[model samples]
Target: MSEVYGWEFSDGPGDHFAVTADHLFAGIWSRPELDLRERRLLLIGALTAQGQFDVAEIQLGAALRNGEFTADQLREMALFLCHYVGWPAGTALDGVVGKVVDQQRKSEQANKTK
Candidate 1:
């Protein structure tokens, strides 16, 4: 996991929670019909539909970091959601997505400078 993300899963309650969550997550991810990208899109849609923008933002950030999608792709998804799910949810996400994507872009630029 550290190979994909710069951080490692810490030990203790958080680790236990992560392990359980990953087990459940892996069941869906392991399905032959859905590749990682497809699963990510499904998760994105579900999160949006359920009004779980915070968790959706986290998943979007991870997906961006992992090169699963581009910033443009995320923006497009948000726009689509605005159309289908209503403007309120998409409006609510504006700051969240902006902050995350801005931070990620800065991080990427800093890494390049190093």
Candidate 2:
């Protein structure tokens, strides 16, 4: 939600559609048909399959922060993805997930020491 690529809906032409799409998806996700964890797992699979690492990283981060997934579970998921998405995609996802877990640990430690 924080400025995507530093561009906001009021930034210029074509921005409106981007904002609209974001809002629409938010509303769609608000429905109770599916658990948020399930949606996040599906998104992680889709993004990883599509080789959308950056987007996948964001979703994975959310999954971690929200307690939807643990680091060990994510690593297991990455391994499971390898058979379907190929080693490179799975490896890239693992790298990103590892970094996210590391960041979370660092942040937690920092807070504890304060």
Candidate 3:
């Protein structure tokens, strides 16, 4: 019962979709048998295939936090996308990955200083 946007599925349609999506994502993330690295890579590939850049970006961050992928891994994935999904899709992800990499670098630098 963590509150996500203060809305519950039992309330309404919008809430139902949001809650269901959240639960599904939680289930995927919490599957005990799947290794974190495998789960993250699958999620990244799925999101990329679906052309969901925003969600892919979020997943990329999660993957990085979970130690499933490094910034180089993400860049390589983007390049791979360029070959398979076309340059436009890969180009779009470039900015998202850059931002994530920058933020991660800053966070690491701050931690090192601490």
CA lDDT, every model vs. true structure: 0.75, 0.80, 0.72
Model 1 gets an lDDT of 0.75
**For residues 56-85, could you state the per-residue lDDT of candidate 2 as single tens digits?**
888777788778899999998899999999
Report the number of the highest-lDDT candidate.
2
| Best candidate according to TM-score | 2
How does each model score on TM-score?
Answer: 0.79, 0.80, 0.69
State, as a TM-score between 0 and 1, how close model 3 is to the true structure.
0.69
Cα distance off (Å), candidate 1, residue 37 = 1.0
For model 1, state the Cα shift of residue 106 in Å.
0.9
> What's the C-alpha lDDT at position 81 in model 3?
79
Q: List the residue pairs that clash in candidate 3.
A: none
Lowest summed lDDT across 10 adjacent residues in model 1 is found at 1-10
Candidate 1, residue 94: lDDT: 59
Candidate 1 regions with alpha-carbon error over 4 angstroms: 1-7, 10-19
lDDT of 1 by residue, 21-110 (tens): 476555656668967778788888778878998888887888888888888888878888888778887665655677779989999899
